[model samples]
Target: MSDCYELFLTCPKSLEGLLVEEATQLGLQEVREQVAVVRGQGDLETAYRLCLWSRLANRVLLVLARFPVQNAEDLYQGVLAVDWHDHLMSSGSLAVEFSGHGSGIDNTHFGALKVKDAVVDKLRTADGVRPSIDKVNPDLRIHLRLEKGEAILSLDLAGHSLHQRGYRLQQGAAPLKENLAAAILIRAGWPRIAAEGGALADPMCGVGTFLVEAAMMAADMAPNLKRERWGFSNWLGHVPALWKKLHEEARARADAGLAKPPLWIRGYEGDPRLIQPGRNNIERAGLGDWVKIYQGELATFEPRPDQNQKGLVVSNPPYGERLGDEASLLYLYQNLGERLRQACLGWEAAVFTGAPELGKRMGIRSHKQYAFWNGALACKLLLLKVLPEQFVTGERRAAGDESRSAPQNEPARLSEGGQMFANRLQKNLKQLGKWARKEGIQCYRLYDADMPEYALAIDLYGDRVHVQEYAPPRSIDPEKAQARLLDALAAIPQALDVDPANVVVKRRERQSGTRQYERQGSEGRFLEVVEGGVKLLVNLTDYLDTGLFLDHRPMRMRIQREAAGKRFLNLFCYTATASVHAAKGGARSTTSVDLSKTYLDWARRNLSLNGFSDKHKLQQGDVMAWLAEDRGEYDMIFIDPPTFSNSKRMEGVFDVQRDQVQLLDLAMARLAPGGVLYFSNNFRKFELDEGLAARYAVTEISAETIDPDFARNTKIHRAWRLATR
Candidate 1:
């Protein structure tokens, strides 16, 4: 056997450079870096040490053979050329993993099959006795990489990925892999901070990955000290004495490190469910004395370490995967920045996030950024020095003014145009506030593009503000439009006397199909607002439209006024706001139908919120299909459909202009005698079918449905009342 063997250390992308440095420091010779891998030459003891010590590597492979191959036969021949008996016994089991493609092997499964056949055939005896395939715990795990028509075969020294540190059996929805977490800590300078006897904290720690990893590093403990098995454990070349020596040395070092006073490492998770699991993980890692976890919210997260000790604050906050999540996440990052400024002065901070744009919203300048891949998603690690100088308090007016160092949560100073916009908002609020207060309305439209340059519709739900910026015209410069939007956003909180963190912003564009009903966020946060004596749920952060339609307030009120002792039917009910109003107004029963199960579930919540679930029915199906099968008659009905929809659940596309007659006729069939059916749509160019007037008594009620709040935009929605002729 060769005294030295070529080794390939595989890691996550962008860690190859760090792995090369680490491998060299671990006594590897001729170390070189490659994409997602580092290559070096090491002896048996060196290989074993690397496996036990590497913090960034995912796998440690010992190259067995390298040969040129051009076809499947060539691949088989190349793998068979290696002496299998020296590595595996005839009674042992083996597994083969093949990566890359070409050499006439397009499918990875087929490539793996060929490699397995070669090993089995070579190990077969005259009596056909050979090794069996055992994927889970193989005596020999072979890896073949076919690249550029050359095949490189190796033995996987680590049975599974090294990232499975064995301490984290339970994790949160999205947990960072231990190796990735280690790399982040290294980049954040956690090692140096720990070496200096500094403390560490993770405010938004999910399952305590960062806390455990930091504790292990600080205590000079080998990450894989607790692992029981490896790919080479059962191999014939395995040296038990050498491995035992390394293990004992590692244990002694860990024991000695633990003998000293442990560094303070704490984690705070907002979810109560994760608290016990995090404590279990820390205990399993034998870091109980060094690390502690508590259930705490981000708003109240304050880490107290020993006096006169400064450290690193590291966290991997959720970046969100849904569409509208960015808007809500903006506030989370803002809060994190605020907390850092308030509590962690003179400390360093590392924030890992998939949304770099949202990270920029933290209002703290990141001195450096490192790019990483969390699985397939590209992410950034923003490193910040939480000093007063890094706080972004807008532009400095003159030097060293006390006002210039204002906190990030403070309302930003307005520009000339912003002041003008703020003045307009004040004027509109003064006029609308009185009317809304007198009408007992807690939610109303405060501004609807009052200034064309701003092009935003600001709605007030209780004390929270929902701002929708109309997509700028193609002729408008995007940069200028963005500046104008900033101006308007800055003006909103100041003018409305609300906190800056209470504002949520989203861009509004012409939606097609069922896009409007699609979930934009997953926060599931709902605000209760009262309108027309009904308590309704409004999720300003999770959808393009809040649950309660501000423009439809008058229509809902009209429905309530006429709903006494009548059966009510609401189609395209959204979150069933209208149905709630009807039920509140003493409707005998209410049935609401929509295509979204999410919305129906939300409707159920809204109905339950108002203590009206018993007589209320929430149906989840295509409204057209539901209406066709529904045989019960309704005394009063209201339908407000989208401008256009191509939902997959529906049979075909629905165009308000083309399908209006058919929709109205189908709905009219369910309308009982003397019943009134109110139909409305927001299609700007919609003209009522003239034939409906002849078929039934149809009266245009568009004028009466427009409330004083939506008076500026009279065409918000056109309404009609129809009955049997």
Candidate 2:
């Protein structure tokens, strides 16, 4: 046996460059970067050192063979060609692991079985015994990977995924993996910089991944110090005395730095629910003295001053997409910007943002940007430099702007010399709207949401943005301007962001109607709109009204094409456009049901506009209530329901999560034998109810059903086509 073996390391994303650096530091050779992984070679000592020191890689594997195979027979011959006696025992258990990317083999398990057969059969012929496959935790684990028509075989040197670092006892919503966290810290320069007293903070510290990692790196701690066991301990080539010495040495090194002056590390989150668990994690890591937890909103925060050097501020704020839509998150971002300017000057900050448009609200240009993954969603970590001049600007404000506009998180402005600046801002926002479309950004707004006085606004919806503004600041009195703003707002509708309803504006505190019509919307007493050769009333006075859903415009166009020849069943059928599509496509009949009589009326108007008045059937009743009555069949159906809602008139509550199974089953019952069910919801976490795979062909047609404009809203709803095989 050789004293050295060529080892290959599989590094996780964001950890690649750091892994190669660490491997070099530990005296390994031939390091290289791959897609989300790093590969290198070393001896047994190198493998052992990596197992203990690799903060970025999940595990290390020993390369066995690199070969080309065209079919299952070739796969068997290749696997059998390996010297099985060198790595596996006749009686030992073994498991075949597999990964395929752009490979001809469609079934991963089939490839794994072929390899397993080759190894076991070869060993059986040589020693009259064969290793059995043990999936849970095999002593001799073999991994097979096929990518781009070539196959790679390797022996797993580390058991488990290596992310179970033994310290994470408590998990919050979407806690990041340990390796990923370590990589991000090192990549952010936490190791080299935190040592120089650049104190760190994660204000919205979700379970303290940043804080914990920063503390560990500050103490020169290894990321995998808490791991209970590793694959090398059981390998026959292991030198027991050497591993023991290394373990003892590592523990001594860690203890040597244990009593050093506590790092000025702190993390704060207002949620009392998170504090106890966060403390639990801190104590678990033996870092209680180094990290502090606080409870409060960022609105009132004061950074600890240090005369030595600027500090570091890093936060992963909730993207508008995290809670729901972009329109709901502008104020949060605005407030974040205000707090940072007011409280965190003289600090380098990294705002790990998934929404670049929202990042613009911070009003500070990012000095650098790093791309990384936060779960499946790709994110941009924006590095911002908080200059010393920021607070100076906030202090020298002029008079007459009693808005006391929270400047820390607001766009910069000058009251006396405002015309040039406002024009620049307006122009930037307009340009941002065009850029957002080209880049296909999701949920980035061009304007701040709480700017109640603006006559027009645009939400860019994400990173692809160019910005501009309109008009100049006039010398009107604050009170008069406020009155005009109120006049502008007093006329819009309740469903402001959705539906084809007109906008209405009404005062919040007025005792009676000053304009005679108290309930009619903002500007629609005599408005008429002609759309698709049909004349319809349009109201832009209220909060919402005056046009169709701009986003769903393409969906309507889709309906007009597909509705002609099929009868339709529209569930939760708001305005019944799908029914219109089915009718226009030459469908025999259309039945639309909804709890809203107003919507049922609107559905009729839509059908009449398309000249399907005779074929259109509108039913104003609770969908849940009417489902059990054995309603008539249709060739096409549309099922769209509110995520969390109740139809009080129907004598029961209808919540999507708790009631999806019954509703989907009901929709299935209403469908014709060969019909397609178009089910959708805006709730991102909605799951298709289980156990109906035997009854119908349920294909998640969400991607296919969504119009071109709504591409990023993949989780908005799931559609299914159902039919017996």
Candidate 3:
């Protein structure tokens, strides 16, 4: 045994650099960083200090030996060569943790077993006394790594992982590890902020991990001071006197730090269930006076510290793992951004998230980004300075002019072609505004590619405008198309007398498979618009199409008109706008079917918004499969499926042209006697199978379904009414 020991400090991936820096600061010499592991040289006291204070390390390993091994026997011999009496008592319990593979030991469990056998065999006495295996509460924890035919054996100086600071016994569904949370706080410059008497807040503080970690850091508390056990506790080389001195020093530093004025640290969670738990965690960290937890929603999360004090707004908002989780989370992130802008101006923000794309929807720019890992999921810590300049107004300036910000009171001037586009928009609005007000319609198409050069479909949803730019053909120069788009966007706000921030833009191209249904953005901004005396929810920014299909206005009205006292069915429901109409029109019952859980969830919200949840049922599955299994009959059925769909949830690709006959037959089977089946699709080349007309009385209602708004595009979609002969 020597006074100096070669040590390996292990941390979560992406924190090796930070660990190296911290270890070096803690007097570790010659520190070298590898992937997830930092190698350095330190004395026994330095190792102990790191176990107590190092915020980023998972384990501190004191290297005992390094030897080459070609097979399992070689590994056994190598372990046996170590003098067991120097480290562990013969009767003491131990645990063996082995990592890596090769040298004929491919399985980690087998490798660990072999190491344990060698250690126990070497320690056995003449009377057969030997160490027993204790996985938990082990007196000695040995770690072995087989790398490139060499075994590196070390003693785990930290008993359990250093991340278990002993405060967070209870956590949320996706609680960040203590060490990782500390790392995030450090990266967010909490130390600097705290030293300046600044405050800290987390709007979505589940279990108060960030709040506790920040308080501990600010109070200069040793992270593992309260940990009851350590791997070196029972080791023969343990130096009690030196350890006692270091522990007392840490305690004194914590006491002195606590004597200073406490920083304003608070956390707010939307879930009331987590509020008490978060307070418990804060109390466990001995920070009850310095921190408080409250039950509050993200929409109303405003952190009020002492007067004139600004700090950091840190949070790990849920980045959903499920398919449709992002859609709902978008608004959460957006709301978070909005709160920061409204309440925390001039303060700093650090949002740690697994979904960086969702972070972009926050409508703010992060000045810096740090990559980290939460277990296996790669994550990012976005650092933002919440200033007015960092706010995104949702308006994209033209290329080469992105740096210039438009004045708040003045609108951007339109180009010559933009003026023409603006005039056309004004003409259409004047013509349609009269009709819209006369009919009491709050949502309708104001412009639909009226000028081909500025190929756009602009719809007015209440006061906001939803603009969809038709992707230019290959023959047109992309730059020209982009210029035209900018022109149209600029003219829209002024031409329609709407705020620029109220416009949402998306590019519309020929979509294949389920691309059309996929989310184009995640702002999750939904607007309620009235049509036919019923309120419907429409998300202007999330999907390629708003939840409400404006072209289907007439058809939905028709459904509402004939729905009185009738059982109605909506196929490929798509947010169930028509079903809501049916429910409002006094339908006996309404069943809406769609394969997309996202849309079904939206449909549920739509139904709930209109107070029609009980009688209107929303089913999630392939429409065809659902129709086949359904045994109920309906007086009126509407089938408005996508032009083509290759959704993975379905058994096979659905070509509306190829599968119409089978689809109609399956749907018509559930249609009651004299029931009307209204079928529609947008495929321009689609031709109804002639055989269907012979079997049932079919009438083309395309003309009747086309409203004045979509009159210019009569072929936008074709509809037909089919009934039994």
Candidate 4:
């Protein structure tokens, strides 16, 4: 026997040359090479040799069954004919793994399921006992492939995906699997270079996979020598004698090939998440005693030991995929490139990136660019060798595919959503008087209110902020909610009297049920008003309410003192503070109106808490529509409508900023000549349409209206005192 055995070696695309070297190094003759795969004849001894030696190959597969099968029926028949019971015990468990083909099969998962069913069905019929199926791990892992319409069934020799490499106890977002890491090292010619005293590294060493892979290759250990078993071990015709000899020989060879000082390998990770996993992987690869893990920003990094020099530096930087901003990721790569020039000299650096912009950032031309697929992500592995002269100067000169970094003095542009939120929140903070502070108040304002997503907060006092989250309103422009939030923040200061910086606005991340994130804009607040020997410091600004509603700010304060020994009326009293003030000031009676049953109940509670009657009239009806049909008289009236109001009960659109004149005119017609009307609006640019001021005593009281907490701006509310002529 010439020791002829079937051999199949898999390589990541673009690394064919490296795989060829690995195969030849294993003493396996390559009778055939097909694109990403190399197939040849080898004995059981040669198979073990390749398993112990090859670093570039994903896995060395041993073909168990090759059939020109087409449909599901053919698949079932071919699987049934295999002498499965010869190697597998009746008590053994099996897992079916599959890949390749779309037109011939609906999907890989479905194809794999069909293959599993066929294998188990065959065993049950022929041997009278079928093995159990294990998805996680199993005694035998069967691999079925339908490629280019040809179905080939092979035993997965590496139990866990070859990527397991027995390393990495942790990981980062979208980490590179271990086998792929080793493949890149071999593909980059690291083994050949390492054998000659060259070095290797990964600057963006996510979980240290590439560095660990390089270390393992440098150690001269078979990638799978640590692995326990393969799918073929349980196959019908498996040669126990040959496999045992091959396994032992591989161990002996690996033991003999150990280097004295170990190849110079380094793995650098800027993210903390990758460090632990990287450490675990290095230890698992039996290289933990050799490799070092570091956590720091790539740009400000200094080499741990200045002595190690002139090897390979590989980095997989940001790719602008499912991450923060695209500009942030780009800046990260740009700074990374600068580091390569400033710190890494007389050395070769390989950058594996999904973003090609990385090569441009390095400011150095790549000698070789290898294209590889990092999980359906088309990526390029760029290689740059720093020559001796270039290394000494340690300065970058821009050339093809490279450029200068962004100038520090240049203006920064924010996303529209971010800008709107920041701008509006700042403006509102400037005018507010009351602040939600942790020491005095507890809930301090968090976000100023800008973001496409909805989140509004009123800091109650520290640790507790009343939070309100609203969705985008239909029938309005998409930016309406955002615009309203800005408007709300701007007007809040006049209503409360707080510094602009004190109010913070943050957008809430939408999530299901209890997992959602909410605002803590204002958690602690100490500002409290005293009336009738009672103290009031609870923050109404931390939630959706921005403390004092500027529209009602003047009205609340007016009613606070004026309602003493007088009748008071509050229409659409959301927080019912005005009605409470009336009762606190010793008013004879009070009435409140709102469509919300929840708020109406709240208004009744407000009156009762202030020693006023719960018997005070509370109407759950549209204010505009209800007042149109009925008449009620009061000694003093405070009517302030929102700039834009739409209710579930009315078809009319109420625009207080624009419709204040007509709205006030109606109130005046119902008012007694001496009965005063306090009218207000929150529209900052509000200008009273001419004739109204002439008809009534309309004095602009905006300047006189403000509280200490809302000191951000005085113009947050527009107020007027009107008495009929």
Candidate 4: where is the Cα deviation over 4 Å? 1-6, 10-17, 27-38, 98-127, 147-150, 187-189, 257-259, 270-277, 304-308, 320-323, 387-725
Better of 3 and 4 by lDDT: 3
**Tens digit per residue, CA lDDT, model 3, 619-722:** 88998888889999999999999988888899988999999999999988999998999999889999999999988899999999988899899998999999
Candidate rank order under lDDT: 3, 1, 2, 4
Off by over 4 Å in 1: 394-428, 449-457, 464-528, 534-547, 558-639, 642-654, 662-678, 690-704, 720-725
Q: After superposition, how far is residue 554 of candidate 1 from its true place, in Å?
A: 2.8
Tens-place lDDT digits, model 2, residues 1-725: 56666677776556577778988887678878887666777877777777777776777887778888777777788889988887777787888888884434678888888889998888785537678888877767788888776778888877776666666788777677777777667656677677776788777886787788788778766666777766655555557787777677777777766678766888878678988888888888888888887876666655563553556777777764321133234445555666666566656787877766566556456777777876677777777776533232335334332222345433332232233334433654456546545644333333332243443333221221211122225664645443333222221111122211221222222122112112233333433333333334323333222223334434444555666667778777766656666676677788888877755666777777667788778888878878878568767777777665444577666777788778878877877776677666656677676776766777765666654334434443565655544
Tens-digit lDDT track of model 4 for 1-725: 23566777776665566677668767888556777788887876677667655666677787777776667667667777777776466677888878886445757888888887777776674547778988876878788878766778876665555555555667787777666666666556786788877767567777777777777677667777777666556655566788778778767766765645766667777778667777887787777655787887776654533355467777777665321123345446545655766566556777888866435544466778888887668898887775433322223234432222423322122234535655555555453324432213223333322344534544433333333444455655645554454444433332344433344443344333212212233344434544333233444333334333433444565677787666566665664667777777777777777666755665565555556675467777766776676477777777766666665566576776667777777767667557787777656677887799788877877666654444444555777888877
lDDT of each: 0.87, 0.63, 0.88, 0.62
TM-score of 1: 0.85
In terms of lDDT, the poorest run of 10 residues in model 1 is 396-405
Q: Per-residue CA lDDT of candidate 1, range 285-308, in tens?
A: 998898899889988776788775
User: Candidate 3, which segments miss by more than 4 Å at Cα?
Assistant: 124-131, 196-204, 268-271, 294-369, 377-436, 441-551, 556-678, 682-685, 691-699, 708-716, 721-725
| TM-scores of all predicted structures | 0.85, 0.58, 0.71, 0.57
